[model samples]
Structure formats: structure tokens, C-alpha cells
Target chain A: MKNNKTDFIQGNIACVEGAIVAGCKFFAGYPITPASEIAEHMSERMFQVNGTFIQTEDELSSIAAVVGSSWAGAKAMTATSGPGISLMQENIGLAIATETPLVIVDVQRGGPSTGSPSISLQGDTIQVKYGSQGEYQVISIAPSSPQEMFDYTIWAFNIAEKFRTPVFVMADVMVGHMREQVEYPEDYNELEIFDRKILDDPDSTEGRFLSTEVAPMPIFGNGFKANVTGSTHDEFGWRNVSDPKVMDNFIKKLTNKILNNKSEIIRTEKEYMEDAEVVLLSYGSVSRAALETVHTAREKEIKVGSYRLVTVWPFPEKEISKMSENVEKIIVLENNLGQIYPYVRSAVDGKAEVELLSPSVLGEFFEPNYILNKIKEAK
Target chain B: MLKDIEHPLQKYIRPGTNYTTCPGCGNGILAQSTLRAIKNLELDFDNIVFVSGIGCAGWIPSPSFNTDVLHVTHGRAIAYATGVKLTNPKLKVVVFSGDGDLSAIGGNHFIHAARRNIDLTVICVNNRIYGMTSGQAAPTTPKNSKTTTTPYGNMENTFDLSDLAKSAGATFVARWTTYHARQLTKSIAKAIDKKGFSFIEAISQCPVHYGKVIGMRNDAPSMMKEFKSKSIHINKIDSLSNESSDDKIIVGELVNENEKAELTDLMQSLRTEVGTDG
Candidate 1:
């Protein structure tokens, strides 16, 4: 028998429920606006689920603790908005270099610097991908509603574990604070949980970071006696900063683990694209407006479609390129000043003209009329 | 070539790895003292995880100690160690780092870890300068001391790290210099034996930059002599006048109360009270 339960809940609270369902037993975070509810919910809910939640001193420690807990053989996560994410970049790079499986939920507010803590803005689309100071690939999911917040958070953890890398759930203020109905499974066991691949031969003496597929992680206390470092290292996790081959092979494998597996990692939602002349490309909360714009534009005989990005980091290039070939124009809508627009334009690559509709400031979401006007212009 | 007789603590050192420190550097003594403490306690080598931050002292544990080691980013060793300890309370977690890494950049973690009374031993080597970066003024550097960054003289007052730990509610807090190797080792052993957050400040020498700039001895021996002359044991602090005692380096155990509960144990009790089993 299928057990169904639906509850009206805040998106951030749903995120906590989703993380617990996904077996996130350790949560280390510092409270930041637009993202504090996630930590607050986790603090109260974690103990009930036999999990651990630590409110760290700051964002740096939060991510660091998450990384450490992940290595200690637990599913760990941390959530923060823009400024906190900026402070966490150094450790985020460490997580990437170490190939630690953890989830970072960026409940993006406004910024280049604390632009608007209470307002909703999708300003960190590019930052989540390239915020850290090195060459690496990141996996980010953009959820458009409260239901998707619960669903995609689980997806974020599973993907983080599957690929053995840090994954981001890019949410914003509107979706985070907005209360809505979310359907959840009665038994969390029914939800899919992806456990990280562990080393079969811990004492093999071979390189731990083998450049073949996803490398198996060794827990700290499992007698593997693994030496983990953030510096450039060889396969066995020993520092070898001088060797060019070691650096090249190590970095290439780190990137290829995600890029090579793009098909399985990338996720998107497409609507009414069969014969539409213009498509509205958006993600997160802005996608809600795009969805309405598509319906309203079609009523006025404007052959417009909607493409919502679920996985924003890998950029859904294949789908965008395919859509561009069929569509006359693409209108990209975001909450910030042209963060994801360039990516859409690059993906469309002049096959179809790409127009951007971004709010001039931080606090406001896009009105349907604004997106409909862009659809009209594109048409 | 036949090997020389192995030192008693040679078993603790990682094979084929050499200490990466300047000659006459006090980090070597600090590392040896730490190993001696662990040896004295006879801790299960397999269960000991040495976590370090980004600094000269951070290198003291990793690639040197034959144990599970995590060399983390700058100033986050305690934070990382907090996670390790909480995840597996049975694992003996130790944070080994320097002054700038701990008190300067990682100050918040130090205070909060102590405030929560988390179960971990933090051994911070206070060389009074950022020796790895050719000696910048550190948080533990004496006020008005000269360094590469503070060529005009450091105007900011330095932190008394042990006092800071005591005030922050650390269950065990002690201070010792590299010259007091035996005392330092014994203090570390007692700290490890304590159940809550433990902090040991090892005032050490960076002869090259710190010594040369401060007009102290340019060699480890002379620096040790200077420390010996300036040091006053905790028991004798009352014998000296208040004016004279203000400038003296009082070295001994300052706090050793175990009434406060450890964070992990408290968390466990909370779990039990909430009727959840882990």
C-alpha cells in the first residue's frame, strides 16, 4: 500500500526533511539569512532522526566540518546564502580537490557583497560553478518550488555521493521562505539513497585517487590510515606538487568524472517545445513566472515555450542547443543582472537570438508581464 | 648502509619522511614532545587522527606521524577535528597547528570549541611569527615586536592564548615553551587525559625571522636561554611583585576542572533523553 502525506510547509523546512530522508546524518552550518531556516529545522529534526547537527562558529568551519564528517563515513551537508558561500569557497575547493561527497545548499540572496539578505535573487548561478580559485567542475540543481526543494535536496545528496564530489542545490529567498504544499513519502526508506563507493582493497598500496572512474573513499578510522591533503597529490593521496603528469592526470580525472557522466547528471524540464517559435529559458523561482508567461503568451497566439533547468551547473547544453535549432529566439529570465543569460546565449550560440530579462535590483522577483513582454519582443 | 640505532619514538614517525623545518627550529622539539606524550599514554595508533591547519606547525603531524592525518585549510584544524570527534567519539582527535593559524585566523573556532567544551586536544605552537611566510607578526607576537609585516613595530597587543582558553571554558589549559620539553609533554598527557576541550600553548622559537627581528638570540640555544630567564612558574607568580609579574611568562597548568560536560557526551545524553538510539 502506498502511504501519502501532504503538508503545507516552508521550502527550507522541506529541505531539512528531504536531507533527513536522504540519510544526511551530519549537518554543520552557521546561520545566515534566507538559509537559517534550513539549519534551524535541522537542529530540531536531526536528533529525532538519530543524526547530528552542529552550528559552527562561521561559514568556513561549517563547510570544513561537513567535509570532515563526510570523510568520517557520514552523509554531511551545510547551507548558506551568498556571503557565507563566499567565505566557504576555500574549503569548497578543498572538498572538490579531496573529492569529498557533501551537499552545499546556496539559498542565494543578493550580492557581490551582502546586497539584500531578505530579498530573492538568483545571483550566484555562475559563482556556484566558478566561485572557488581553481579548475574544477561543479554539480548544481535549481529547484523552482517547495516540492522541488524537498525532492531536489535528496537528489543533491544522491548525486554528491554517486560522483564523490560536492553538489550544490541553488535556491533563492522566494522559494526558501514561501510556504506551499509538499507531498512527501510516509517512509523515508522508500526514497533512493546513494552510498559512496568504498575501497574494496584498502591496503592495495595502489594510488587511492586512481584516474579511471569514481575513486573509492576510505573512512578515517577504518584502518585505511589514509593521508588526505588539499595540495596537488598523486593517486595514493600523497603530496606531489612538482610533477606535471601528476597534476595534469589528477585535475583531468577530477573534471572528467562529472563531464563524462553528464547524461546521468544533467536534469531539465521542457514544456510546449514541439512547434513553439520562442522559448523562455529560466530556473529556480523565475521558472514559475516563465511557466505562467508560456501559458499567457500562447493564449495571445505567441508561439512561446518554457524550458526549466533542474541541473544548472552542467548547463543543459545539449537540450538548449537542440531547442535553439527549432526555436526562432530564446528569452532567458533570472532574478539577478544576467548571471545565467550568458550561458544560455553561449549554448544557443547565435543559432537563435537569446534575450535576457533580469530585474535591475536584488529584492524583487520577475513579474509575469515582464516575461510576457520579453516573449512578445522575442516573437 | 647500516641504520643508526632507532630512536624510541621512531615507530611513531612515518617511514622515509623527514621533518620539513629549519635547522634549530622549535617545531621539531614540539613534534617530538607530542609523540612522547602519545607514547607515554600508549594510545591506540590506529584510532588516533591528527588534524592540522595550513602553517609550519600544521606540517608537524602529517607526513611525519604514521597515523590518519588530515591537513586542512588555514585556521580550521579545530573545526575539522570537531567533526571528526563528533562523528566518531572513540577516535582520539588532536589538532596541531601554529599561532597565526589558530589564534589569528582560526580564533573563532578556538573560542567556540572551548566554549562548547568539545572533546579534542589542541596543541598550538606559538612561534610568535608566521615563520612559513618569512615571519609576519602573529596574534601571539608580543606588542611592539618587529616582523616582516610589522617593520615599524607591531602596535597591537598579543593574545595570552592559554588565558583565552581558560576564559573560553576549556577544561584543561596549560602553557609551556619548547625549552620545557619534559614539562610540555607531561602537560599534554594531562590534557589528553582530561575529558573536555584541552588547549596547550607551546611558546616556540623561529630563530631566522622572529629572533633576528626582535634582537633576541639568532640561534635556538640562545632563544631557549632567553625563555628560561623570562619564565616564571605558576606557583611562584605570587612571590614576585605585581609590576614585575605583569611582564613575566607564567608557565604551568592554569585550569584543570572536569565538572563541565563534553559536547559529544552531552549530545549523546540528549539523544538518549529524546528516546533515539544511534
Candidate 2:
């Protein structure tokens, strides 16, 4: 915890508080269900902190404004749901391509097309990873509780600023709406915040884009005369659309910047994984239920542990795959229909039998008894 | 023999022009007029950020403006520029895009930006068609004027973008053709100087697909000549309703008012009033 000072607040409000602590000076969003309180609270908080806030005409403009403010050297963000995220995919791609540092807080809701508005559905787990066009990698975090919601948001901004890329905090409906006590810094100065590395000597020949190491950002209005375009460009930010070599380098750098730093970016919390024969794996709100299952199964002398992913994307394949050697079975749990199951299965390979334990009901959390019964039934 | 001296505007031009417009494209004319506006007003490139969307007109600022420029995705220039302006009020943000990029897919952003009365100088080059996409019908395309998307002649009425801006609460609104180069330069300079949202619709000549579709000589000079004869100034018009008539293109400053509060200044004021230490 950053500070012992704690306040009981909603998950969405925790997120807004974390953002304000992270020194986010600009926010633009269109309010949607399960996440509307974020914008509602953020509007008042922004004025309190002297930050700019805009309730955009639509989701596309929301993301667009965030991207624009990021370039203008502001720590900018937007909050929306699955439906709003869908509208923002194209601009998200634009942000990725331009290497803009910003945060997108998607309070995950159920949907292929406007699914349950107020339900806890982890439907957007995979969508956030692969929603944007083209080949790109983005940092994503799935906070399990309101406490994690507050903590992980600051984490998201650090990764975004360090790598100069868009990061998503995919908090689901239950995690977003549930009220809980969250510890935060009383003095904003006590909070840890990171700013993107700036290109100090723009007159030098070195360009802004580098392959493996994160390149310094030449933010707008800084007199860098930097030309940034969504079209394929070289390190100098000059347009080079036709050259395949430039295009190859562009995509490679965009993804490798995050992938190379995966060790620090990927976060997971584990309990009793060393002695467990059966493992319960989940993220976001379902992880709470997984924790309960671990407690109940332990009472029966059955070896079971809970594995919660705090940072989901740049998926922690290596750590889990290594753990799979000890576990007999890894039971994946989610409120939706096994969205992350395939990735887990592929990561586990043949070391452990991996299967998804989707909730019997679409929106409800899995009861501890149901999970333990399913684990026993597989016996 | 040519004199051994540099062109006055050469200092503002950037290095790359390999992806530039056709020899007779009006974007070239409007590009200089824009640069000239910045020069005439003595604005520094360091303090100005040019944002443009996808189109030939969008290229005016990207590689040519010799300043910080953001060439964004199609139809979102206004939204991006809004962010830039609101974030740093010291930096003058200019959005240079085309008719198709502004009034078609970007219509909502264009109108809403006007409604907010943000401090951004938006110059929409109205070439009557989607020039970069090979003359598809655009929202600003004249009704019954044939285009690739409307080969049988466009059935929809065209948008008078200046009228839309005037009604949508833009503090400054003006319409000018590329032929009115001097006035176009002055309007752009004045718009940039204005406090709130300013829109300048530059009626450019697209002599390729648009020229062939509407029966022209297929040259910039001929289309530009037509612009000179078929134009009527707003000052000469007796009634506002007839300015949108098909027979003539209305030109000159339509509206220039700065009484409304600007978005960036308002944000700054709100931040000051509430304080930043919360």
C-alpha cells in the first residue's frame, strides 16, 4: 500500500482516484453502464485537481481526444465499457501506431452487441487484447478487487509512460461497481508517478523510434518539429509507406517494446501453488471466488491453490507453464464463456490438464461449493 | 536569368514532397495560403501544431508545414486538434482537412467542435468530391453532380459547411475559393487570430474526377476561371436563404464573433477556481 490512509469507495471511484494520483491531467470519455460513475466522479475530481475533462459526443472522439492530449504532453485517459471500447478500436489502433502514451479504463460489461448492461461478465478479456487492427502489443491489467483497482491503475500509467504505448485497465462490472475500502496516498506527492522519456536533443540525428529499447517521445508543442503520422514511418517520424523494410521495423518495434519488457509488466499473485495438486486460475472479479474455492478445498485436505492474474496481457505464460509441472489440473474460471481458456490451455501445453469452469449462470459468480464439486467430480 | 535568392516562404517548407498532390491540384495553392497566413501573422512554428485527417488536403500540414503536425486517421482531425488545444492553450492548434474528411464521416466531430466553440483554426478545403479517393461523392458535393459513388448523379443535397458552422456556434466562419487567394490568405490569418472556434471553407477546384463528372475542361486553370465568374460575396447577398443556391458559390466572411467563452480558457479558469491540490 502507498499509504495507510484508506477510504471506502466504489471500484470506479477508486480508479478515478488512482488516476488523479498518477497525475492524469486530462480525461475524455462517453459514459456507459458499469463504468458511468468513473466519468461522473472524474468530472468533479478533474475540476478539483485543475485537470481538463470532456464528455465527448461519442466513444471515437473520446479515444481520439485522449490520444491528442497525450501528444500534447498530458497524462490523458478515458473510461468506458465493452460497447464504448468497440467504438474506440480504430482510434486505439491509431494510438498504438503513433506510440501515444495514454490509459483506457474499460469497465468491462457483457456484449457481442450490447449484452447485459449491469452484469458481471468477463466478456471483454480477449477482445481488449486483439480488438485493435494489425499486429500490436499493449499492456493490460485486470484488478481482482477494489483495492487492486486502485493499485493497478497507477501500475497501468507507469507501464504506459515507460513504454510510450496505450495501456488498458479491464475492470469488469462487479469489480467496477462493488464498493470496498482502498488504501491510497494522503499527500499526492507521496504517490509514485512516471512520465514518458522526452527527446531532449531533437537536433541530434537519432530518431524517436528504437527497436528494442523504448525511444524517447517528442511530444507535440515542444518545438521538436516532429512529424507524427499513422502511416508507416521511419524512426525520424517521416512517412515511408512503400518500403517493406520500414513497415517491418515499425510493427516489430511497436510490439517488441512491450514484449521485451514482459518480465516487469506481467504481474500475478499466487497462494499454495507449490504443494497444490489442483489449481484454480482466474482474473478480475472471478479471482475472489477462486480464492474462496482455495479455502474450502484446503479445509477438506485436498491440495488446491488460487492463481490470480493482476496484469493479464503480455500474458504470464512462462511463470504459469513452469507451475503447471507441479499441478495435476488447472481449472480456469470466468463469468463469460472461457475467453481466456484457450490461452491458458496453450500455455500449459501437455504438462497439466487444463479446462475452463465457466459459471453456470451468465452474470453470477461461481459459488465455492460449485467449484469444489467440479474439482471433485473430475476425480 | 533567375536571381540567386531564396523564396520568402521556403523557410516554412519541409524537406519531403515526394507524396505531394498533382501539378494542378488546389491543395498546393491552399497549402501556401495557409503557410502564408502563419507567416503574415508572425506565428512561430514552435507554438503551432497542425492536425490533419486523411485526404489530399490533409497532406497540406503533414509533410509541408515545417512544424509539429499530426496526420491522423480518416475523419477525426477536429477531435484530435481539440485535444491538443485544450491540453496546451499556449500552442495554437490548426486543423487543415478536406470536405470529405470534415463533413462526411467526420461530420459529427466537425459540428460538435463548432458547438463547443473551442479555440482551433479549422480550414476545410471543399473540393466538392473525395479527391484523394478518385472523386467519390462527398457531403459537400453539389446535388445532382455525378461522382464515382453517384455515377447516376448525386440525389442528396450538398452541405453548406460555412452555414453549418455559423449555426453551430463557431465564433468565426468564412467561405472562399482558391481563386480568391489574397482573401483566402487574409481570412485564414484572421481566423487564426480569432479567439474561439473558427472555420474557413476553401472552395478548391478538383479537376480530375470532379471536373470530368461536372463537365469541365479538366484543368486547374479552367476550373479556377469558373470560380472567378460564378462567385457571389456574402456582402452582396440580400438574404441568407439564397446564398446556398445552386447557380452561384457564396464567398467572403460569413460570421466573426468572439463573445462566447472558449473551451481551453474555460478549462483553465475552472482549474484555477477549484485549485490543483485536491
Candidate 3:
């Protein structure tokens, strides 16, 4: 810990700084509580760097503006809470269907409406995956601390640009607003910046081939005629509402690009799970508490371990299934009411005992005693 | 502006039978004026992107135009238009949608884009009723207008487009009626030439939907006469005497000829500030 260089920063500020280091050049967002700090950080940094920051009138415009900025050859992003995220769903659908590269940070708070502003909750897990009208796969990440907020934001933009789809940094009030020490990399020179894919020859007919989902991307201002549309489209970006083959190919490739690459996208961390009887599965802010609980249990000789999920959207099913295969039991913990618990319990398949722990909105975190008691029960 | 008149769009309309407009509809006038403005401005045909959302007015960007047209999801024209404009900042981005599409469902985008003053021309057709959905109450519908949903008169107050734009930080805002085709056409041309967010609210007639309810669907020529008579300048909004019974005022050019920093300009400034570290 002393060897690593650490600078204290809030979770949202770290996210903004991380995006800048990751080469994010455009930010469009509406100011929402608990998440407004992301916009505020962007507002100041956008002026400090060669990036664009815009405060839209609402969440719809915020996401729309980011979509526009992304098309302009910038790594664009936006941040919002529950209500703003709801407003952004349609545009998010458009981004997914059109294969636009963007990063949306949803700093969730308690509510279906304007719930607790300062409080935290993980209620948007299902919505983040399936909130849009159609069935589209998404890449989502859950950062458990300020450091992860910074690191994961960089990874989020990289994945978005690589896959040419919208990626989610699904954080909550706890990790979004929390202040903690985050260490910057020793050599910042190693981070790879992924720019918008470009057409090599603007004049060649091959340049037009960049319109398809799997085709090479044509960057804007490259003097190419690349027509893009949100409708069911062909490789040429022309509307093909009547062609089933075109629809099938477009949807297949759009979903396949991310689905086939899940191994590379899915990331997880495991700690002392090989011989432990009880394993805790957690993500976002709850993982931090689970880590502490596991440490306490380890000292007490209860043989408890933890599995922390960094990338949560594809749900890290393969990693969890592999990690928990030998464990005697698994306990899932979160701030929302069983939002992700069912997935965890179903994955373990009764070979090991499965349980859930969801904290109420009363405070910042759950008591370590509660988690310790659950681990004892699992034994 | 004769030297500015362009082709493609100007040459698209065929001399044939009326297609689908209602018998006394004002959409024809709005579409015709838009066409005339495109011709008058001599805008590049290939670079002209006409974006529309789901509504009766959304059809304007469909078969009606020869240039690139994007018919997107409901209340999302502005979003797609932003995409188009940002990708090719040199392109002329024109958005056409109904009052409900822009002010009601799309109001969040409407005000935000206006506030940012993005360099896009938004031509909103305020027909006072949702025509495609049949007679439903719209954002601009009069409070007393009876519609399918509001059989007992609309209790919600109508949205005043000009006022909303002014408060939301639009650089240019204007209102024109279908009967003011020539003026509306010139206004549209001016908006296209302006370098910031320009909005033109074209008050239209929804005859099949609203006409049968208000008993105003007689002759198409007579409907034009009413539009010509009732339309007034927005500046006289305050000076108009309350004594007149014919007080349904359709004002024109509420706010015009103003300049502000565009979103691109702001981004450029930010880039300068962020410097080499980025």
C-alpha cells in the first residue's frame, strides 16, 4: 500500500479523471443529484482539455448529445441517476441498434421515481440489461471503489470503442459519491487509446462497405459517404425494412460481436476460495463490505472467501460457475432487494449452499456482524 | 436570395394529383414552404439531412424529400439530427416533427438543444392536435379544444412555442401560419442561413381530426382565408386590444436575428483549455 501512489478523490471525480486518461473527448449530460458531480467534473475538465462538455436540458438530450458527439469521432459519455437513466433508454436503444460507441455512467440512487438522492441502491441491474424495448445485449461494469471507478471507466470506454456499442459503468450512490484513496498507474504511458474506426480510402467503393455492423468503421470528416440509420438496415446503411436477410444478418452480427467476445469482456477477482467452505459473491459498493467481512471471517478461522465482479453485465457466469464449483456454499450480497441474488443462487445449482444479503436504505453499509453471521450459517 | 435557390429538392415535386393531405390541411403549405426555402437557400442536396420522428408531420421527411432523410423513433428526431450534424458539422440539419413530438414527448431534448444552441434548424408543425393518432390533445392544443381524449375539453394549458424557446435559450425563434407561406418560406431560409439553433413554429391546420370537431372543414380555400385573417405579428401580442371577439392571434417572428455561441464553439474552447495533457 505504501509503494502505490495514492491520491484521495471522490468516486465520481475519479470516473471523470479516468475517462480523460482513457482519451474520452466528449461529455454530454444533464445535472442529476448524486450523479451531478460527474457532469461537474466533466464541465471543468472539458474546458481544461481538448474535450467537449455539454449540460443538456434533460437526460434524453444528454444521451442524444453523447450519441451525436460519438459519431463525430470522439469517445463520448454521459452520467445520470435512475430517472435520467429512464429517459435515456430510447436513445440507448438507438445507440445499440446503430452500433454507436458510447459510455453511459448511471450513478443509481433509491427510486423508481426521484427517490433518495443521497442514499444508495443497486436496483437498476435488470433495467440496465433490459430496460430498452427490444432484446439487445449490453456490456456493463460494476466498480466497487473509487479506484475501480477510475479504472473501470477507462476499461468501459475502451470496450465501447472496440465493440462499437454503448457500454455501462453501472455504479450506485455509494461508489459514485464515496471519497477514498485511488492510486494512479506508475507509467500512464501504457494505456491504449482506441479512436473511432476509419475508412482507409475515402474514394473507393470499399469505403462504403464500412456501413455494416461487422464492417470496418468509417470515421467522420474522412470525406466518405457512409450513411447510418437506426432502422433495420443493410451493409450499405440503407433502410431495408422489407429484407429479412438483411435484418437477420444485421442483428446477428450486432449481438455476436459482443456475445462471442464475452471471455475477453467478462472480468472477475477471486480471493482464497480454493479451500474455503463459504464464498461471498458481490459487486459495486457491497463488494467492499464483503471483502472486509471475508477478512474478519478469515481471521476468525471460518474459512470464508470472496468473489468480486468487476464487469457485471454479461454477469460473469462462466467465472462464477468455475470459482464456486468446489466451494461448499455461496452468499450473494447487494444493496437492492434480490436484484442480482436470484442469478447468483441459480448459478451455484445447490451443489453448494446459496444465500442472499440485501441491506436496507438506512445507512452507508451493513454491519460486519450480519455478514459474519451469514457465513456461520452457511457452515 | 435568388442566387441561393438550389436544386434536387426544388426539382422533386411532380405536377400530379394531391396525395394524402386532408381536404383542408395546412401541412401542404408547410411542406411547400419548406421546399421553397430549400430552393431559396441553395443548400447542398447531398449534405441536407431531413430528420423526422413518429407523427403525421413525420411523413414530410419520407417520400416527400429527395435528399437524405432519417425517419427515426418517436420524439427522437432531435437526437438523430444531433448525430448527423455532429458527424458532419458542415451538413444542413433540418428537423421536422409535430408539436407533441417536439414539445410534449420530446420536450427534454427540445429545450436542451435550444439551450445549447446547436447548429440545427428545427421546423416544428404545431397543428394543435395529434393528427396521425386521430384527434388527441397536443402540447399546443387550446385548453378548450375537444378531442378524443379530452371529450370534456382539455384542462391543461397549451404550450406557447415562442415563449418556451425564449426561456430555454434559443438563439432564433419564430412563428408563422400555413397561410403565410411566402413569409414562412423566407423565415425558414433565414433560419437555415443562421449559424446557431433556429426554430420555426409553423401553425398548421388538422382538418380531418380537428376540423370535423370545430365545424371548420368546409372549403379548403375558405380555411386559407381564416388563416390569413387571424394571423398577427407576435410583437403586437401585448398591444392587441382585448375588446375584439376575433382574438385568436397567430403571431409571427417572436424572436429573431440573434447570435450566440454554438456547442461546437464551446467544445473548441474547452479543447484549448484542456491543452496537451488530454
Model 3: lDDT of residue B53: 83
Write down the lDDT that model 2 would get: 0.88
* Candidate 1 residue-wise lDDT, B1-278, digit = tens: 44887889988887777787887899888888888998899987778899999989989998678878899899999998988888888888999989999999999999999999999999999998999998888888888887788878899998989999999999999999998999999999988777899999999998987888767646878889878998999998989998998778899998989689899998887777774434
Candidate 2 falls in which docking quality class? medium
For each candidate, report its DockQ versus the true two-chain complex: 0.58, 0.73, 0.30
Residue pairs clashing, model 1: A208-A235
Error of 2 at B194 (Å): 0.7
Candidate ranking (DockQ, best to worst): 2, 1, 3
Tens digit of per-residue lDDT, candidate 3, span B1-278: 97887654456442231347666777777888888888887765556777788888887755456555556678878876776575457778889989999988888778877887888999999878888988899878877778899999888987888779878888888888888889999999988888788999988887788775577754556556777788777666566677652456556776765557887666665567556654
Better of 1 and 3 by TM-score: 1
- Candidate 2 per-residue C-alpha lDDT over A95-180 given as tens digits, one digit per residue, 9 for 90 to 100: 99989999999898877798888987888888788998899887889987888888888888988998889999989888899999
Q: What are the TM-scores, per candidate, against the unseen true structure?
A: 0.96, 0.97, 0.84
Going through the candidates in order, the fraction of native interface contacts each one reproduces equals: 0.64, 0.88, 0.38
Ranking by TM-score: 2, 1, 3
Model 3 fnat value: 0.38
